[model samples]
Target: MKTKIILVIIIVLCTFFIGMMLFIKYYSPKEKSNQLLSNVSVVDGKQIISITAKGGYFPRITNAKADIPTTIKLNTKATFDCSSAIVIPGINYRSYLPPSGETIIDIPSQKAGSSMNGTCSMGMYGFVINFN
Candidate 1:
């Protein structure tokens, strides 16, 4: 009886340890690429040029705005540059983003159909460029 109890206790402890190990392995956080949005539009004419950052993490843009020559509008603040900006894929244009707390960019209507891309702290996020 004593031997049986000891054996049962050892099995129970082993099962508990195995369960804990699996839980930790499954639930542990790992580094992952940040989520991106599809086809963010700024205005019509303007296009995103390039995004730069000092770190690998996303860069927050402040007082973001879109400019089509003289027209400019306030946009929402983004956790990263392209996190809020829109791209059209294949376009070779970029925007001069301001350093404020606003996010969102407005592209000119005339340039809406062309391919464009947004700049991110990590890399370029393309949108609406391969729709031909």
Candidate 2:
């Protein structure tokens, strides 16, 4: 019957739409953040870099001053993904971040033109900090 065929087509279309939505939500690349300028600050002569880690690290790229003692803060709120497992190979740092809190790692003063990179445990998500 035409009615039956139409109903089947509708159901198939709905299913396809839902599947695509789910894939885009969890499997698609992360959106870039526009908070780069606000994420870095100097407090009492020490540089502080703030990054939010949820589905992935935000701001993807951070710019900061070099040759200053620095602390990188990884903030998380209800993060249950691989991004919580942060790894910074340059400093030999690796750890599992809490689900809802902040993790701070001290970084020594870096020479200008150097950079540091952090990635999730699975290496599926990452971010970079450039010193200038």
lDDT of 2 by residue, 29-90 (tens): 34323334679999999999999999999979999999999999999999999999999999
Clashes of each: 29, 0
Best by lDDT: 2
Pairs that clash in candidate 2: none
Cα miss at 23, model 2 (Å)? 39
Model 2, which residues run further than 4 Å from truth?
Answer: 1-36
Q: lDDT of each prediction vs. the true structure?
A: 0.38, 0.93
lDDT of 1 by residue, 18-121 (tens): 99998776665321221232122344544432232222212233122233321223343433554344332333444434444433333343332333334442
